[model samples]
Target: MNLAYQAKRSHLLIGLMSGTSLDGVDAAMVSIDTDEQKNISSVSLKGFHYVPYSDEIRERLMALCSVETARLDELVVAHYAVSEWYAYAVSQLLAATGVSAEQVDAVCTHGQTVWHVADSTPFPGPNGMMPVRASLQIGELSVLAERTGIPVVGNFRARDLAAGGVGAPLVPYADMILFRDAKKGRLLQNIGGIANVTVIPAGAALEQVFAFDTGPGNMVIDEIVMLGTDGRQRFDEGGKIAAAGSVSRELLEPFLADPYYRLAPPKSTGREVYGKAFVEQFTGEARKLGLSFEDTVASATALTALTIAEAYKQFVFPGMQAEEVIVSGGGAYNDTMLDMIRQELPQGIRVTTSARYGIPDDAKEAIAFAILGHETLMGRPSNVPSVTGAARPVVLGNLCF
Candidate 1:
């Protein structure tokens, strides 16, 4: 169903993203039209797809992720390789669309995040604090521009970090604009490799918004799947295996009570906190207590859902008065996780996927980056201060000519 509104657009952009889900690249082709106030923005996603990563590349990427300096050079090469890979995906997508390069205005790529240490930063020269600001997403946009012969806007996180923000959950800015409901408060929860939320108060000023990381989303669950299945599975498909297992409340209770869950908003985390080390600690403790593999996976999934609901109640709802939690990302496909969230949510707060708004849950993030690219090319700020904690609104994303 082609929405009649977007047919009048003057710009069409394709956005690509490979999120924390560690699943595959999601590419979305959107045609957008914005007005002088930037308030009258209309967009239609003309096409979208989730292309799974080849086993070989997926393994290699996973192997290099969050590795120490010993593999720094290798990781750098991997980043560039992934960019080319994404370009190839985009080229195929365009070819399949029968839309010429001339018909497309740009390609927006989220690249890939290996590690996000938004809590700290490298030394900032001879004086002031390092701004605790630095993030790396390596899929050279210039190469994408060169290969696709389309102006590309990528590396969107650096600007936020430069302005003293967590530089994570940048997608919330897109959520605020695209998903806000004028009648009811909206809590947009994305369960990618990482789970984060954006709270938009209906009819409130932009500054009244708030968003942040809710804790490990698919990061821990994927790790457990890989380990328990001996690398046979990239993820816990459909939550079937998880549903068959039992959650260890004793173990899960303590994990849920983690201080990170209690921390104030604007906080961020990555594999650094919930990665291999975190898994090792979790497993080691489980072993010490003689927990079963099923128990481990079940608890990890529970933690992901519980943390989101807990965060919403404590921080977001109180401020935004959210009555519905719109879900998206790979986690939305996890039936067990969804069940936990639906059960865990307080009465009156309904849970639904991005599909309710005509956006494919899997491709929403990729589409969002494409929208951000649209914003950047038009000389706009994509940062939501309430979400990113940045110093005022600033135009984000680096343009690679």
Candidate 2:
């Protein structure tokens, strides 16, 4: 029960994430041990928790992402408040689980992403030099570190984006390290607001590993539920709405045709492409087709399943084959979505949650970053060039103590 015990080689981290959907804060207390050789497999999930945001806060954050910039300044302050909320979550997790944060090596926080225009944004200089493509995550780390008295490694995405990597779908590094199966080869699939997958073929070199955003995850489904349910529910509860109605391939086929789904690995997306505006378009099309609320939900779920399934059969699997697909994130909890995936998948591909292997589906993304922090502490690079198409292997994130 003494969670304060030092790791074998003096490395341990608590990873934190509050994703695009603004659902809540995820915090995981992890134990990491590594040798001088830099081969890491020793990992333990000591504790974890997902703290839901209050309705007021969730709405405020959502508004900023789509609101008038004249009111943007307040959103920046709200981001700091997010970090404080994150700190509270981390503290509650330790107290509830009997873990001591002071003993941990680092706290890896994937702060909330306000804007992720990787290839946009104006460069700051004379003569209005066009701003290079970059992104920003705006949870002040100093708040978390100062409040918790822990070394915090945040801004996980900027470094990779700066180096020309997509800076998204970063979980693949953890996938290759901890989830790879030498015999069967494995595919680690995350279905958050966006769906991404990493292919770990048996005997595959790091160069051979591949990953990318495989189209819609929960973004569309959640959005559809929001409008259809009049905000009574944040998402399609257990996909019951989807189950209640039939899908119109007409509404879904056009989405399936989106070029983003067909994009190869090293590609990334966010609320930018599939945010609320996109959902409005979906609802408008469904209405034009005379679809019911239930039908719209069903079509939205169909899109999620088809995109992921299509990405695998089309882009992810050619020379490589994965017998088992390990699923994680909020989408894994939706039975109807999973059923859709099972229906669409080619025969013999088994679907299971990452939680079955002791990683909470909701906690997996945050936990991956916690693991990434441990890697960075040990002089290991968390960005995989093959998977992310980064120009080179570079350490990700800026550490703030």
Candidate 3:
């Protein structure tokens, strides 16, 4: 059988995603089929699994995200260790689904984004000092392929960055495939550690799609919870902490004024802007305001909700006027956060989760990469040029067999 022919037909692929939340890995077994033009014809989720990172591993990844603490030796070791965890996730998914590694077509892994800098900075290059945008997602693809005995596709972001893109919100292309509606415009809002939205206009073509990071998602709130609990808790769980307190306007106002919220579209951000260092400043401000820890958490939750609504008001509503905002990722589980977003938005825009559309919030990203990996095998471009500000549509990811 011709390999290219097989790629166009329905095949089983597994996708692994370890998002910015630094909580765990999500593994999804997906069945995808493409049309003659290499466009997705159909996709379905067959099985899914979650593998929580040990506290030690989470700490190590957090360290790697910071420039102040990362060491080259530790980065090298963590890369290999993270790949092992990804392979373990694949093995667990295969076992739970009664499948075998040999039966699968490919494995698509996003790895772990320890550092992502999308803004152009003057740096040494082949042509002397030049402006460059860079991002690093580390999980050794060769190690994963060697362990699983299947071809692997990883580092999906690097190719986009090379093509002059921000190398983020890469899932917008997949969201278009999964959520586009003919008569109703839709906004696919994903709230990982960072929050991003894909705006698809009513009966729009591929060229009309646009997206960008909205601001902090659960990163700040999670950091506050972890700090307040002395590391006993890593997140708000169900937004309970925030629900128990009031949103401190003093704290909330400062956060809402961040310059990132005012940036134009085609922008992206990560821990570099909202990580532990930002959280420390937030906590210091809270202490000065005499606000309790719970109040600070509520304020952070409000920050995420208000910023998302503000992004829509400023960038999305003016053009697309989406009828619904479909929320996903860990933030979807936060009821208080959801309610706040609902209240902050203008009337008549429904807020819901991906589960209503047959995709689990936790598994959506992993499933997306599964689709992207299949595209790579078919020699099709998956990056959305408008969303990432790439020079052109380009096939993403490097294959390892």
Candidate 4:
């Protein structure tokens, strides 16, 4: 069945995203309506559910992200395991929403990103010196399609990478549709495992969008909490732990000086830069400096705010006059993180969450992929050349029926 043809009527899509946090799969059931010109005039997120990864499953997936010498066989098994979980999430969504699989237009998933390197790093090449950039998102779409009995669109980044793009921050394209405002210059900031911001000038055209990752979000802070509690806590719930401590500039400056922070826009990053290894090294040095556990977590939380503020000061604010910074993802739930960002940024800017508009902070990313799948089904290009540094705009995602 051709998705585009079926989408001539209203389309309902389920977007699944398991972010670098390795927490769980976020599934959003979105109803979208497109005009004859294939422009999405309206979209509604009818349902949202988060199916958490069991401790064992999360351990396996996190190991895949950072294991010293993970075997290919292990990678293969984890991939299918993730796919089956995604299918389970889809079933759960349908059951909760009272929507049948037969009625769903498609299930679009971003899969689990075990590795993503978007810069010109030199790796072993066929002959000699070659700078290659690559990314891998596992969870077999064919398995998802087979299990769900619905068309699945996965692998949404390869074509963009092949066209010379970073294949990241793909959510900005969806930001244009989901959060753009004609009167207010809005900054859509998603603070997931990795933090990223998309700047949309008031009534800005697609080309005017500016976006890039702002270092670590919940990952570093969460890691510190996990270590502090010996894995008893997955995150710093509501920023209480962070609030209990004081931000240490001495410890925070090193994180700010990281080379990744200085890179300009059209850039992206992941756990590859701010994951377990990075957290362990920073925490080791913090303990060596006699910093308390609370202070260490506080500093990491402040790093997220300071880096985001500095990114805006250097890259975004000068070019785009943002009225409000609307935050999303797991970080939005952290009151301390939000307060730090609000204080670090200029007073003129107001910090809030996507929920103020319509979408919940946690569900925004999943919703974005759902919208992207709808665009792909409509035969419309979804990746912004300026945002992802692609050679040109291209329809993203691979279709599996």
Candidate 5:
């Protein structure tokens, strides 16, 4: 069968995304149709399902994320195990939607990112020391394809990285396909474990778009909540803990001073910079100030909000003024976080969730991967060179059949 021909027509694709949140796998069943130019003409959600990760799996994955604790043996075991988890998610999605594996065209997955180092670090090469940018995502695509009996498209970051790009914020190309407008410049802000923004200038072409990770989204706040409650709570539900507490400028000031905030676009970061160790240090500073648990959570939430607003003020506002900030991902549900972000942003800019545009906030990323997977099958270059700082635009994802 001609995969590209099939992709040009209407097709059903399931996108699976397990973000840094480590909460669960989101499976989005999307119906996509491409225009004569092979650009997405119409897209709609058919069904959505989520599979929560067990405590044991979460612990194992968390261990793999840290360099100090990640072992080769564990990585080998978890790689296949995570594929099983992804298969389970696909099965559950099929069951929920009453669809068959043969009926679907492909399974697009953005495997769980364990470690993402977008910045260059010197490492021993074949000849000598060389600057390398590396990232690893661990769900095996072959295993997922075998279990699901459908072709799989995944590891979407590797090709971009190979082309001298940061290999992230890969969703900007998809964001343009889904949210771009002719009259209004929009900022697509996704607040997952890490918060990233895609700036789509009004009526801009794909080459004109750009994006970068603003800073920690729910990552730092979730860590603080877990630390404060002794693992009793994984997150501050509805931002209630933060709402109940006070923001300590003492703690917020230092977090705002993080050098990552000042970095130019085409950048990305993950648990590497703001993971467990960073949270431990943050908690130590909070203790030095004698701050309460709620106060610490509040301050961390403020850091997310302020950093995002600051990124926009410094980078986005000077060139393209976005009329709206459309938020998606786990952070969209955090009322206190949303309120803080709104306060920090300038006047006349609207803040809203992706749901307002008919895309579920939680399912937006999953749906994006589905579109990306379709592009891969159609032999299209989906990576935005401007957003990723790649030498050139390139098709992303490794296909497994």
Candidate 6:
């Protein structure tokens, strides 16, 4: 650990995030303030930058994420490659902000989640059967620290998983810090590759907040779009393609029936369940139904929207009184996804993007990990037990000094 960081009341830290989307490394230079009570009194984003992955890197990451394609040697190589990429992103961010590494406290990175298994996943055990809840986030902190000459915090999910938690949706803790409203109940919905919601009741305390992944976000939609475009395009980009096509209930219903959706809160998921293989199955279904490219993309988009509303209604709305859903992540930019969500949502609830509050939809996740990094340095237990089904609260993030 950096001695200077230990003694500071406020520190400038770069938080890094590489989500399931295989998009890019997002770094946010954040200025965070903490009090004697170990609570965040003030937090602000100083600067942010995103460094996209090349086609080759994205392809390797996709292979490593698959059981049939993953190679141990490539996993090791990609791990270091991702760290270098993250270090490069940090340099770019500092240049963009005119800041130096020595002036910063640390780089807190969520790394890249190659594989994640929640508590509900059964595995063979010593004497009987048990749930093997574990997670992996590459981009080694030691490598990052060596490259950047800055204290690094990495592999944040391990601690939570060790404590018998889902090791995901760690952003909810940051959501409480960044989006908690005193007078109004708000839902912070992050529609990244995988969609998740953080339900904050009006004036609710830390313990009252709850969150869970709401099932497929832009992950499925992007996959369908990629297939349709033959890698010519990456995403729907404003929902133009999806808007051009009609939703197919035939295709969307089976996805809604996924067992993961029926699981209660304190749950989470990732590409392991919704990655290449899943996309292949989805494509197969679309072909069997003879759906056009636009209709397939539209169905995938609607699946995301319908499942989000359904999760809120069945699990969240019963106890929490939320007036609006503050959306973030890539899905927020998809007008078609938003429109579908609004149509399915209850009549009184309003939907809006996080841009309305200040954070850009794309930068919100990156900004979140930055806050979590700060909390970790403060010796704060940042994971919400209520949201992750953890046995107890534990300080997340491993330090590479």
Q: Write the per-residue lDDT of candidate 4 for residues 200-241, one digit (tens) a residue.
A: 999999999868887888989988999999999999999998
TM-score of 2: 0.93
Q: What are the Cα lDDT values of the candidates?
A: 0.81, 0.81, 0.91, 0.89, 0.92, 0.88
Residues 1-401 of candidate 3 have per-residue lDDT tens digits of 22753545678899999999899999999998767765678999999999999989999999999989899999999999899999999999999999989889899999899999889999898989999899989999999999999899999999999999999889988998898899999999999999999999988888899999998999999999998999999999899999999998877786787788889989999998899899999999999999998999999999999999999999988876778999999999999999999998889999999999999998999999998888788778999999999999999999998
- Give the clashing residue pairs of candidate 3, or none: none
> Which has the higher TM-score value, candidate number 5 or candidate number 6?
5
Clashing residue pairs for model 2:
122-131, 123-131
Against the hidden reference, what TM-scores do the models get?
0.93, 0.93, 0.98, 0.97, 0.98, 0.97
Query: Which candidate, 1 or 3, would have the higher TM-score against the true structure?
Result: 3
Distance from true location, Cα of 175 in model 1, Å = 1.0
Which of 2 and 3 is the better model by TM-score? 3
Clashing pairs in 1: 20-193, 21-193
Question: Deviation in angstroms for 99 in model 2?
Answer: 2.0
| Model 5 CA lDDT for position 303 | 90
lDDT of 2 by residue, 64-180 (tens): 666343166777688688888989988988897886876767789888876666445566677766657666677899999998988888887877877777787788888777787
Better of 2 and 4 by TM-score: 4
Q: Write model 5 residue lDDT over 208-324, tens digit each, in one string.
A: 899999999999998889878888888898999999999999887877888889988888999888888989988899999999888899999999999999999999999997899
Cα RMSD for predicted model 3? 1.3
